[model samples]
Target: MTFTQNRLSSERLAQVSAGSRFSYNRTQQAIGIVHFGIGAFHRAHQAWYTDRAMDAGDRNWATCGVSLRSKNVADQLTPQDGLYTVAERSERGTHLCVVGAVQEVLVHPRDCNAIIERLSSPDTHIASFTVTEKGYCRSADGSLDPDRAGAGSIYDYLTRGLALRKERGLSGLTLLSCDNLADNGRQLERLLKAYCAENDAQLGEWIATNCTFPCTMVDRIVPATTDADRTDIMEILQVQDEAAVVTESFTQWVIEDKFAGPRPAWEQVGAEIVSDVAPYETAKLRMLNGAHSALAYLGLKAGYTFVHEAIGDPALRSLVEQLMREEAAPTVATADGQSLPSYAEALIARFANPALQHKLIQIGMDGSQKIPQRWLETLEANRTAGRQCPAIIAAMKAWFAHLRGDNGPVEDPMADRLTEIASRTSDAQCAVALFGEGGMMPRIWQVSEEKLQALFS
Candidate 1:
């Protein structure tokens, strides 16, 4: 029972009543280029850019979105016929975009051969990623993580991909990491090489010689899935999309122009291709993400449940703004050629958007994963250049205080992790003590620790 002369799956048949059936007029497929760690951000940012490029590139840029961790993506996307709607939840209103650029979905364990097959394609132009900071196998010192004891993701993915590529003789694919980590591409290459060296040296050299990893800085506030989003998306697009992604009205991607093969005109799709993404990336991390994490840890402590709520509260709002304007902006460059003062103002305005309802817990999750990429790297850079990092320090100290389960007027620790952290630390001093005990922090952290201790204590 189709409403519009279309062949539809039962789910889409029910959800999207009107649309034509597949006439085998398939859109363009790319040269086996696969993106690792496909998530909400990838769908909203990278895939959006790629889709626009593919449409303009005359179908020369199709993507096979690869999920190394979940069957959720496959289950949601496969049923929808690989189609979903992206909703830009904005201050003014909601904007909907139906994306058809992702031609296929492959789960790592289930579709190993398919992933390799995509990479081996000679025409495969670029393999991009936004796997978050933890996805890269960097250690405390910011080089590749050496120990593979717990079977780290960075090691596992590269280990399998390199071994498969060698067996299949697939050469010269670009690995572009769009996470917030500093020197992201170089670190990614090191991780891949580390995996190869441990298992096979020749493979390491092959990866070193053939594969190129490009660093990138991406910005966007894409919240987790919500039921209302599902309903609204269904109402507007009239589609039953389980893997649909929702994000804020804003988005930005700044990538270093270094790729192994043919790439997308990301610039055509409102992305920036720059000589060095460092300044831009650093600015975003400090201004946007650093501010974000600061809000998450501190705001949650201040008894505010959501990011918007915290921003609305006078005290928390002051804390967020002061850190950004007074402490953070002096140290970094702004995107769109905006002044630091203006950038902070915009960020405050964006953060305070009442409609977005971005959750603090979402930003707060996986601090072990986020800080090295988002916060500490910027702090290290500032310190190295003989620049001051007082704002970053205050944010860090505030974060540490948060870990200790104590805030002055509002003493609220996130309920879920309380038991585990309590077991780990008896008090705030002990909590602070854990930083040097073979943790993710290193010498630069040591340099900043004294300053942070003074602020919190």
Candidate 2:
């Protein structure tokens, strides 16, 4: 390619420096679209989609990456003039692609002023977040979480920024939440509204009257990039890059058609912009994410090191496929997509991909936060039907076992829950309460504690 990494890095301020192959600077040409929680998944998926949007020249929807905490955004993105790399891989082969949609980057507290200014700017019309499922600060029924006290860091920032924007007579921006949580956008609105209500009633009213939070469903298996991925890209593409990313071949984004400013023609570039994201969200959460959780827990318990290892194991892999059949397929409700079984089969094939190297621990890191979204609902669905979910039930059993810390010496990092459960080992009832019953599967609280103890204990 004519635009080489050396040529690009010499001229630009690199954002995140991971030696990834897709780092370059086409960012100066675009406008800001404020983004929070700028992680690997955002770079590999949303940024990639925006990069595709940028290809047409009329759309100037650039991204601004802001960190909530010490989210390690600068550790990767700032060295080579805001340049980084993205490495996309699947079973077929690999490709090196550069994403420069994130035009500006900032870390909070230090760059708090900059973040607020960007949010208040009229030109900055879209505010999207991938702050994680736990980050939403929402309630269980998909509304704003009422539990938190007034004006936390994120909420404070939004409150102040929106007030400033209103003082300048600017309209509200589109707030898109890309977390795996259900009704992510609406949930964000709840949080935003709650914050605004406590701090400024006018701002709250303005947000209710003006802001548009579009519900979205995004799916992709974007793995964290590593040093080995750098070598692989260098060997294959014959290019040296400093922030390459790695992800599976499959990617899907379903956005609601609500934008305050001009958005990229993502629909033109293969993204589905739908009216109701519910069905899409359900399918992805239940089938794809559910299977993923099942694999991570079950795979680890079976002594497998990585996701590929689990898929490679005939017994474990068969067990996962069975879960797909019994639990995942029936609950999936996407109205205009392929059948759930077909999707699960395809996902299984992707999971078996040796090159992607997705780690079980990486997938299993936030099991406490992930399982409710992925598996619990389906488990309940199976219960309602009175069906035999030996494999899924067994996986849940293994997950609880994992949480209980029976298998290892190091106390699996994912076993913090197990440690808590272990504390109540003497009192089975208290222990059972930890899992919301049987000390396992806290998300499925409706299920009887006695039954969970019978199954898991």
Note the residue pairs that clash in candidate 1.
Answer: 6-21, 7-21, 31-124
Distance from true position, residue 11, model 1, in Å? 11
Per-residue lDDT of 339 in model 1:
78
Model 2, backbone clash pairs (residues 3+ apart or across chains), number: 33
Candidate 1 per-residue lDDT, tens place, 155-240, comes to: 56555565566777666777888887767787777777766666778867777777778778888888887887776666666445
lDDT score for candidate 2 against the true structure: 0.71
lDDT of 1: 0.67
**Tens digits of per-residue lDDT for model 2, 254-280:** 998877666778887779998888888
Stretches off by above 4 angstroms in model 2 are 1-28, 138-153, 235-240, 405-418, 426-431, 435-445
Each model's lDDT? 0.67, 0.71
Which window of ten consecutive residues has the lowest lDDT sum in model 2? 15-24
